[model samples]
Target: MFFQTEFTHVIELFQLPFMQRALLGGILTGIMGGVLGSFTILRQLSFFCDALGHSALLGISLGYLLGLNPSLVLLPFAVIFALAVSYLLEHTRLWTDALLNIIYSSSLAIAIIILSFVGQYKGGLNNLLFGDILAVQQLDLVLSSLLLIVCTIYIGMTLRTQMLLTVDESLAIARGVSVSTQRTVFIVLLSLVVGISIKSIGVLLVSAFVVIPACAARLMSRTFTHYVLLSAGLGALSAVLGMVSSAWFNLPSGPSIVATQLAIFLTAMVIPRLRSVTHSPSTLPPQV
Candidate 1:
């Protein structure tokens, strides 16, 4: 009875316009986060996304300084930053983690300096820092959906090359994949996704959305196909459930969703150990 009541309440929550938009945005962000995060984890670029999140503050500050919509200013700044980072990553020897840290720290410092002058340009700054899914707008939903579609199309068109590059860059190069271009395109897309998602997921936790679900999916995947599908599915599932959970408990949506994803990741971490122990020869019943 309790379960039925809760389920009914969840269904009823969707009747509200805000809830509907939040769910749609969550699903779209989930798919993008999962797919991109799989690639990010494989490439060990968790710091990269996290750093991009930090850098967004500078962009947000700039938007405030200019008295414009934050996302409008944020997208261009993020793309420019991505372009620069991609160039340096391809051309220089600096570690990606180290470079990203330097960039984000510098950006945060600059953002602070600017914020001091802008004088709380908008109250929405706090929301950008920590995210607010319930407050997500229709534009955010549309942008995230478009991101999902673009990512899907790009991956679909270049699946083989992407896989080869991820698994073996040398082999991909030998197979005629343009590694540089592919990397740049992927980085740009990552930036755009990060920029657009900041309003909904916040800079502090958006990377969690990208990294955690993919890591959970990675735990038991048997094949590349399984890995990709599982990661995306887990991401979408976590996002949807997280939003529902947040609404039910009146929790902060960003943190609640991330916590849910973290829980799933922990569960994934334990599952393999349990499976191994259960399947051990010593555990088999002798009478069988």
Candidate 2:
């Protein structure tokens, strides 16, 4: 009786219009994060994604100053930032970590300074910083759906080339892949994903949203295709579960989603060890 009542309550909660929007938004964000995150993990560009998220604040501030929607500015700003970083990595002698740190700190500082100049901005910066998924609206859903479709088509067509480039740039070049172009395109797409995701997952948790599910999938997958699919699946699962849990428990949606991903990661970490222990030769011998 208790279980039946609880299940009905869960269904009723999801039937709310805001909850429905939040769920759809969360799913789109999760799938996008997972799909792009696989490449970031393989290319060791996770920090680059984080830097992009931080740098987006500058764009938001500029948007407010110019009386434009922040989302309108964010994608272009992120693309420019990504291209600059890619160019620097290719031509400069500085280490990747140092360059990213410099950009991340400088951009964030500049954004704060700009915001101060904006003076009494009524925009909810907290939503940008920490996220408020429950605040998702119809336009957000429409934009997210379009972005997801575009990203999916791009990834589907370039998956093989991207995989080869990720594995070995020289080999990819030998096979006639344009290493520079592929990397640039990938960086731009990643920037777009990170930019869109900031609204739902927040700047603070975007990296975790993108990275954690891929990491968890890595532990469970034995092949590249499997890894990608499982990562996306896990991401979608976590988002749904997190949103439901948030609605039921009155928790912050972004943090709840991240917490769910963390739990999956820990479970992925432990399951293999548990399996090994359970199937060990010592245990088999004892049984014999």
Candidate 3:
């Protein structure tokens, strides 16, 4: 009994190379997801991120068909598709939502077709769609790290402009913010985050990383900067905990991490309401 219990505990983590990689990948993924997700939620672009994720599936298929690296091929493709979508939305009379749906559905179908043709490999589609964080390579790790640094620095330096644009684009333009240029930059950065996270979170659940933590932060933070920071922190915590838990239970890391995030989101949603009820209105100062 003692040996069995010990073995179970040991297998959960601190025993496998794949487990380490998954944990590291999750941390990086969370950072990037949290940073981009704040803008994603604030700008009402969660749908856009989902579209980008689906569109990236096309790139993944092309990679498998051509025997190239999926991450490399998917990165440029995601950026291109995101740019195309954003451009079409702004420059043409097309309905942005409809256009996004078209791109999303088409890309996903194409990927499924291509994957069917590719047939079997060791956990191919499973890794792409649901993710196998334990199988993350050094190349993918390096790529994610670089993208995370670039995004953090870029967004930090342009915080004011991003916040302004998120709240009211026309007003931001009136205040001398270049709407067109800023919008383009924002879309490109967002796409990069999605691309980088593809391996860690997979196509199906990547948007959860972007949406859940930001929603949690919304409950906890009052200022924009604090909200971003809080979201990032939550993301990191979830990544670490999920990775460890997955390894221990021999579960899928991507889903485990996302489950952790969902738990946080639920807690955030509930706590505020509970506080409102428990706190006394009579003791609190009256609102202006």
Please list the Cα RMSD from the true structure of every candidate, rounded to 1 decimal place.
2.6, 2.2, 3.9
**lDDT, candidates in the order shown:** 0.86, 0.88, 0.84
In terms of lDDT, model 1 sits at 0.86
* Candidate 2 residue 122 C-alpha distance from true site, Å: 6.8
Error of 3 at 184 (Å): 1.8
- On TM-score, who's better, 1 or 3? 1
Instruction: Give a tens-digit lDDT track for model 2, residues 1-288.
Output: 987777788799899999999999999989988888888898999998999889888888899888898889988988998898889888999999999999999988988888888876636667878878888889889988998898789888888987898789999999999988888888988888888888888877888878999999999999998898888888899999999888777789999999999999999999999999988777444644
> Could you estimate the TM-score for every candidate?
0.93, 0.94, 0.90
lDDT of 1 by residue, 10-120 (tens): 789888999889888888888899988889899988888898888988998888888997779999999898788777777879887787778889998999788888766
lDDT of 3: 0.84
Identify the leading candidate in terms of TM-score: 2
lDDT of 2: 0.88
Which is better, 2 or 3, measured by TM-score? 2
Scanning candidate 2 in windows of ten residues, the lowest lDDT window is 279-288
Model 2 CA deviation exceeding 4 Å by range? 1-6, 283-288
Clashes of 3: 1
Those runs of model 3 whose alpha carbons end farther than 4 Å from true positions after fitting are: 1-12, 120-123, 281-288
The candidate, 2 or 3, that scores higher on lDDT is: 2
